[model samples]
Target: MNQDIIKSQWKQLKGEVKQKWARLTDDDLTLIEGKRDVLEGKIQERYGLARDKAEAEVRDFEQRLRKH
Candidate 1:
């Protein structure tokens, strides 16, 4: 998905994001605010994933969301 589209759809995506990454708190989502980099960083911090892994995860998530 495009970054702008992600940002625009953030409010709706938050619940799905939380479901995908249970470790993320609501505060985290607010802070992320649909910024891809921030989301990846939060996912890394919360899940102990490396930068590359986090990026890949986010990419996969975007792809999945695009499919739906």
Candidate 2:
């Protein structure tokens, strides 16, 4: 997605992100905000997943959001 579109949709996207990643604590989302890389790092640490897997998960989640 383009930066402008993502920026405009952040509020809704953020809520959806939190809902979809129920395993993520509020503190983790707060720290990451809209930064996808940071979110991936937290997912890796919390879920014990590989970096690439975490990134893929995040990407897939984002794609799902876009579809909806």
Candidate 3:
């Protein structure tokens, strides 16, 4: 999905995000607030992933969301 769609639909997507990234806290989600960069950073920090890996994971997640 596009950034605009994700931003507008952030509330709805929050639960799914939490489910997918169990290590993330509610605080992290709130901070993310549908910003792709923030989400990528949080994933990188929480999962101990490299920047490229974190970005790829987020891209994959976005693609998955689009598929649904």
Across 1-68, the per-residue lDDT of candidate 3 in tens digits comes to 78999899999999999999999999999999999999999999999999999999889999998889
- Better by TM-score, candidate 3 or 2: 3
> Candidate 2 versus the native: TM-score?
0.78
lDDT of each: 0.96, 0.78, 0.94
Model 3 bad stretches (over 4 Å) = none
Q: Record all residue pairs in model 3 with backbone atoms less than 3 Å apart, i.e. clashing.
A: none
Q: How far in Å is the alpha carbon of 1 misplaced in model 3?
A: 1.9
**How high is each candidate's TM-score?**
0.98, 0.78, 0.96
The numbered model that scores best in lDDT is 1
* Candidate 1 global TM-score: 0.98
**Tens digit per residue, CA lDDT, model 1, 23-46:** 999999999999999999999999
Q: Write candidate 2's Cα lDDT for 1-68 as tens digits.
A: 55566556766677777777778888887787667788889989988999999989988887876787
- Going through the candidates in the order shown, the clash numbers are 0, 0, 0
